[model samples]
Target: MTADTAVLPTLLTALRLPSIARNWKRIAEIADRDDWPAARLLATLLEIEVADRTSRRIQRHRDQSGLPAGKTFATFDFNVATGVRKNHLLALGTGDGWIETGDNLLIFGESGTGKSHAVAAIGDALIDAGRRVLFTRTTDMVQRLQSARRDLALAATLDKLDKYDLIILDDLSYVRKDQAETSVLFELISHRYERHSIAITANQPFSAWGDVFPDPAMTVASIDRLVHHATIIEMNGESYRKRVAVARVKGKDSASDN
Candidate 1:
């Protein structure tokens, strides 16, 4: 091979075009066989590089997002959660104006009502749309922030979370009502208010949020910030899990009869 040909791989590496480096030779062979022009070859390689980079970026985000697998819209039961419209959910999944402007998402539902699953599905969609998202149980995230506060690194911890376009705090009501826990939780809501976005799933209504926040004033403030520019999704219905469990029992009984 000529020195020019031998140096092509190194040049591609230096340019950080791994996709082109890996696929260029095969594409070039095709190009030659097809009698393609130089411009067509370059364009094909560049397009491949761009597409590969985008795919890798999306995968990386998905891996880091902490979203539960199989919770996508396709796997979700839209019929069961009739309160949430499919079109609205699909629009939210696109991460259009809401994610870009740092608007919050509030999902209120009882246990087994598919709040977590819906938010997780939405989170997965946001990741696919090239938005960074973090899905954490409310208590888990609170403990993390509490530890940070204890270590005097609360600000740094919150700043690190800024990298995510939306942070989904599943089961927000699970966090025990305490000074330290609720304080940090309030801080997170306050810090991200309007500047960043948060998606919360809670089983309680705004009136009952005092049970979570301890102090009525803090509860009001938290609710205000979260609701100010938020899309509220109420998923009030029979528990999806209970329905599935009942179906399984009936199936077992029918099998026994057979």
Candidate 2:
């Protein structure tokens, strides 16, 4: 083995990605030959492969259909993000954190904020850490009940809900709830209450949840169980869409100079 290449294999072994390590050898050959264009080409390939791997990992553990795909614990807004209490959110992520070990997480904010993304990211993180997770929009959850009741195996489906360590309910106000949907939702929450944690993202204020359930009494009961042992994250900021627009404009201007 050449002196220069000998040390490279050892380092790549430490990285734990054999394919990446092999790619490194090809990239090194390009660099040694002063083949600048070939080096750039190899670097680009390496970047694409790494990115693809990262995407696969995120998608594997994430509920891509139910919530925003990009939401992640790492990308979650922690700066302007405000929630229950800093210490509490910290604990939620830690093994002993209040929300850490499958305790409920409630994120309440206006539309276009990062509520759904934040919860989804948490669920993704939990999945990667060997916990089972499920994500569903409130509307989809209600529709599932509509199907289950018709099929006569609602109990079995409800049992499936309990199988997950964490469940995410996003867009809680997508449709108005009837007595049947409300009852089923309550049952699921009651069953999971304290036994497992739920992460809920909502565009409506908690006070206005009645519009979904329609029954004042049932709404309060549901909230009591879900929030009693939960952490409430209140996101306050401009629309995330608006923030993106501004950033894109800035980027476009910078690119025009080049």
lDDT by residue for model 2 (163-242), tens: 67777888887757653555677767777877888888888887888877757887898899888877778887777777
Clashing pairs in 2: 91-97, 92-100, 102-197
For each candidate in turn, the TM-score is: 0.96, 0.67
lDDT of each: 0.91, 0.72
Q: After superposing candidate 1, which stretches have Cα over 4 Å from the reference?
A: none
Worst 10 residues of 1 by lDDT: 173-182
Off by over 4 Å in 2: 1-68, 80-91, 99-102, 178-180, 250-258
Q: How many clashing pairs per prediction, in order?
A: 0, 3
> Per-residue CA lDDT of candidate 1, range 146-253, in tens?
899989999999999999999999998877686466689999999998888999999988888887886889989999999999999899889998999999999999
